[model samples]
Target: MNTIKDQDLSKNQLLVKNIVEHAIDQANFTIKNLSKRPTVAMLMECENCLTDFMPVVKFIADDHIEYAPIYDQMCAAIDAVQMGEDLVEIEFA
Candidate 1:
């Protein structure tokens, strides 16, 4: 199972990760035109203890849908790795 094992992650971290992931997914599904570009605002939060991690809203995507999705996916994957088991073994399909 895909997951993250963040030993030092607070609740806010998890929240931020979730929001970013959701935004990325939404962008992928909602945005159609590659030229139009899709943007998403994410609120960062703690992982272990839910809290206001950051005050400023994080923005994803500028004008390149392809790059945005790739970056988002990488960020999400990294976050998952930090939150999952200490010894995570992923099997890509």
Candidate 2:
């Protein structure tokens, strides 16, 4: 017999799995498209893209951390590029 906790766990796992799979797909696509071997700058560009998307994911998937292994795996896909000052701060004029 399934409990409420079991159902919630299942939902979290599915959410994290979907996120991890998407992250992996994005990483593979970035790796494939490099004109030259990927440089730190190029990878940083990819990281920038990921960071741009992260806020939206965080908002939508606030519950996702309950299934951390999959979340970590998603993070690992682009792990090499650390968040730095290059992530722009937007200013409204």
Candidate 3:
């Protein structure tokens, strides 16, 4: 799992992580193609928000089991930030 600096996570990270986690959990086919791993592009209305998150994560996962938990953790971290809470203990299984 990757923990991006709090200062470097976009508002859309929360949304995108949520969406990606859902997709991973629900995708019917085995995610066997490492070269075609799912990519998430965060879209923001404000350029400032767009500038915060790192644009991409490479070598993110080799399969769904690895990807799902990480995506869930990322979403949880972003949610904690949005709720005015400290993300002091975020981790993936």
Ranking of candidates on TM-score, top first: 2, 3, 1
User: How well is each residue in 51-92 modelled by candidate 2, as lDDT tens digits?
Assistant: 655554554446655444433433554454463222222111
Q: Candidate 1 — number of clashing residue pairs?
A: 22
- Relative to the true structure, how large is the alpha-carbon lDDT of every model? 0.34, 0.51, 0.36
- Candidate 1 lDDT, 1-93, residue by residue in tens: 534665445754666556655544443332222213322212111121112211111242343242354454444533543454121111111
Model 3 agreement with the true structure over 1-93: per-residue lDDT tens digits:
766666456744565566444443322111222113422221111121212321221124323354555545545544543453443332334
Model 1 TM-score, all chains together: 0.28
How well does candidate 2 match the true structure in TM-score terms?
0.40
RMSD of each: 16.5, 10.0, 17.8
TM-score of each: 0.28, 0.40, 0.31
Deviation (Å) of 83 in candidate 1: 38
The global Cα lDDT (0 to 1) of model 1 is: 0.34
**Scored by Cα lDDT, where does model 2 land?**
0.51
Backbone clashes, each candidate: 22, 0, 0
